[model samples]
Target chain A: MRASVHRAVEELLSEQPAEEVTLPLIATRAGVHPTTVYRRWGSLADLLSEVASSRFSGDIVVPDTGDVREDLERWATAVATDLADPDTLAIMRAALGAGPDGGCACTADRHAQLEAILERERSRGGRTPSVEEASDGLLGPLYYRALFTQLPVTAEWVRGLVRKLLS
Target chain B: MRASVHRAVEELLSEQPAEEVTLPLIATRAGVHPTTVYRRWGSLADLLSEVASSRFSGDIVVPDTGDVREDLERWATAVATDLADPDTLAIMRAALGAGPDGGCACTADRHAQLEAILERERSRGGRTPSVEEASDGLLGPLYYRALFTQLPVTAEWVRGLVRKLLS
Candidate 1:
């Protein structure tokens, strides 16, 4: 039942903007009572956050081969690809609107993964940036362009950013 | 009459999210007929785009003093400050939803301002990155962090990014 609700929300999000999605509509599509959804998720925002967390957990694979630059490049490229997808962008927008704690689990997981990668680099004698710095320097620009400028987060663009950060 | 409508929209946006803002509500707030707003702007998205264009035109100030880094830092700091405002973020989100051509004037003005600054640098024999590259590397990250991370885009942070890009 939870999976059905999640799948319905995902379908609706892909078809329309997040703002247009409603709990009643999701309930009808999922073939579950609206009360059931409300009981489990509390609100659309909460449900979307859970959906995003589940999707990201399954999708994100942090690559580490001891080379910090290469590893970061791989991870960033994957992120760029995911973010560029319309479906993922809709899910992200929903997650963001759910408030800070709303997306806490997904964000914490990503931060933890980044921290581990940075730690490995530090062990290898490379200058490891703080998680905040890495996020600001790397993920910030990628998402910014993806969300705002309507610019393509191309592979070459990702490579250039990684090189610049490493240099 | 136009000023009243603009003011009413701004007031409404500040009080609530952009999605909830409607033409009838704005008209009522402005003490004008809904037809008046509909005739002038065509749609809520168009009205929001015009509001954004007007606001951005009055707000953005690009500085140039023969130093690219200093100029970019000043410009980015101003942007960060503006973006940090709740009202401005609401308008930006609305404008962004209106599509590329929807906010064409504001975007064109910013791009032109950036081009002029880069042109000055090029004349001084500095390595000028493409406008797209500059947008991706500098503005992209700044706006990205500002919007998504809940991290303050501090003056120090702007300075660090400018230095990194320049180096």
Candidate 2:
């Protein structure tokens, strides 16, 4: 029953704003009593956290092919791809749910995850942070493109940036 | 009269998400009749665009102290300051008004505005397009901070990042 309710909430989170989501609606979609949902989750906030936890688990796997740049570019492309997806963007907006009522909401958890990933990348290949350089490699361009423009995080772009930064 | 109406619309855009800003409500706030307000702006979209246009204009004013690094840090901090401002964020989200609506019911004008900004920035500072490099400088940390954390964008944080990238 909890699993079913969770799935329903996840669906809503992936498509609807939080203010637009209601317990009765989830119950109807999940074919369970609304009472059961409210009884278990207590509120949409609690339920939404669980859904976000399952979705962005900070356990983003970064592959190493003996090339640090290759690894980062691949990883950034994935993050970029996720950001471009409507489902992921919707789920993110829903969880944050409009304004500082959302302050300290899902972000701390999200950063904890990204920090872990960054730390892991830092350790690999013994590449110290480069100050003389122009920018961070893979993640930087991938995210910049995704956030500002409709451009894809292409392999060529990633490789070119990675090579330039690495040199 | 136009100035007063603009101020009223500015207030509306900064309100919490759940609050509605109907035309009559703005009219009352601006000391104008609802019909008078509608007469000038045509529709809510027209009113909001005029309000947002005045608000979002102005460049980061990159100072050329003859050092690109100093200029970059200054620019980055300005960007971060803009991003972390509560009223600014509220206005940004409000202007976008949820979803792929792209900040207006019709996005052609909005798209043109954004493209013009990007192009102008590229040509600004008498620099050429290192699209990736500029993207990283302008957007990389801003998005990372905004999308993932509630931490107010501090001058120190922006300076640290700008130094790291531009150093």
Best by TM-score: 1
Clashing residue pairs, candidate 2? none
Cα lDDT tens digits for candidate 1, A1-167: 98998899889988865545778899999999989888988776677778877877747788978789889988889888887787776666566544443335345566677788899898888797788778767777776666556566778988888887777
For B1-167, candidate 2 gives per-residue lDDT tens digits of 89998788778757634225556888998999999998987655466555555665553454555555565666566666776777766554444333433233222333343334445555555443344455554466565456445445667766665554443
For candidate 1, the docking band is acceptable
- lDDT tens digits, residues A21-90, model 2? 6778888889998888888876665666566556766536655565555555665556666767767655
| Residue B10 displacement in candidate 1 (angstroms) | 2.5
Overall local distance difference test of candidate 2? 0.56
In every candidate, how many clashes are there? 0, 0
Question: Tens digit of lDDT per residue, candidate 1, span B1-167?
Answer: 98898889889878864545688999999999999888988877677777877877746867976788888888878877887887776666556544433335345566667777888899899897888777766676666665455676788988887777777
Question: What is the Cα-based lDDT of residue A161 in candidate 1?
Answer: 82
Estimate the Cα RMSD of every predicted model relative to the unseen true structure: 3.3, 6.1
